[model samples]
Target: MAYQTFRQEYLQVPPVTRAYTTACVLTTAAVQLELITPFQLYFNPELIFKHFQIWRLITNYLFFGPVGFNFLFNMIFLYRYCRMLEEGSFRGRTADFVFMFLFGGLLMTLFGLFVNLVFLGQAFTIMLVYVWSRRNPYVRMNFFGLLIFQAPFLPWVLMGFSLLLGNSIIVDLLGIAVGHIYFFLEDVFPNQPGGGRLLRTPSVLKAIFDTPEDDPNYNPLPEERPGGFAWGEGQRLGG
Candidate 1:
């Protein structure tokens, strides 16, 4: 896909992207207040148990440590991936991407809370991002000027390293399993026309969902007003 064309086609940034970035900013503020700690929410059973807050599932993504480099690196990675996805599927329809990202994170968190309670704090976000990157592996990136492959298998390498470093391999495995299941489900119950055909044009939404389609919405430009332009063109100059 032509990156320039894709970028040109997108007139506006997706709402979900804006919302996510805003949340990250807010998290940074909260962290500075010392009112909350990112790591505490992840591994502390007491914090989770006492607070009993459900928002942690989603808020956890926004939590970055005080380490400026780590936080910047994560934000850059997220921006690159999200921009590629948003541009690739034009019309700024980010509903599905947002849904999948959050849903994947939620699933990972729940799995951590239950199956791998020991690594709850250590492995949630990384696993979720790994799974997402795996499923959408065709999206490539250049690492340090060297062409590095991503999308399908690179996630495993990351997961392996995380395991070697003594992080929760179990949560990573669970993420991979869930990602595969999501892929299979999409293949089976495919999105069809007649679903949200007006506001978004069902074909656009289908592409956003990454569903296979017999016909695709390739008209990247907005539709022209019927006969309106022709009438204007035919009129005498300055009349």
Candidate 2:
């Protein structure tokens, strides 16, 4: 699904989501034009590097390479996970989700850079926001065209494969750490109930928001009328 559609249906989107998505598009375009130096923002260097751009904190979220199966697969997972979170949160509270996502991404990148400078000469952080969001280990997703399985094992599986192939384990570990922190913080401060009994429903929202019995969902309904209180202001009462 397009970002616009998600925004409309969800009724709110955190500013960071827009920033991250924009960064991804720009970074991909630059890569297509043979711009490699700009992509270096994803890494950390010894001492103070001139190429060190502060904007990379946000751009890092968007620098996921070009259009391929990898990108498509990642996007699909992102959409599914993001949408699930959005739907569970109170109506009109997209900012909270965005904050958590960007904050996690930024920390993961920073940790990756530090590890690279200290141990390995190069490191690449994997986005672990989706994995962290899967608080329930039982949550599952369809793999390829056949398999349907849980995600908790997927991260470990990927990490194992990467290690076997001599990939950057440092970056992967840092990403997991960052993801854990994000999950922890989110559990502490959550969105408030919009206004309904739906908030009382036994779901993630109830657990996060700690909504009271009086709190109403306030979610817009189809039959609800909009605008001024009186439908017919000037109509004659006894004609």
The reply for model 1, stretches above 4 Å from the true place, is: 1-12, 43-51, 90-92, 115-141, 145-147, 160-175, 187-239
TM-score for each of the candidates: 0.55, 0.54
- Per-candidate local distance difference test: 0.49, 0.44
Evaluate residue 46 in candidate 1 and report its C-alpha lDDT on the 0 to 100 scale: 52
Which candidate leads the pack in TM-score? 1
Per residue, candidate 1 scores C-alpha lDDT tens digits across 157-191 of: 54665576575567557756666655444432355
Error of 1 at 110 (Å): 2.4
Off by over 4 Å in 2: 1-19, 35-40, 45-52, 89-91, 117-133, 145-148, 160-166, 188-239
Candidate 2 C-alpha lDDT tens digits along 48-116: 256555555544455554677545544543433344344454234544554455466556555656554
lDDT of 2: 0.44
At residue 193, give the lDDT of candidate 2.
Answer: 46
Against the true structure, candidate 1 reaches a TM-score of 0.55
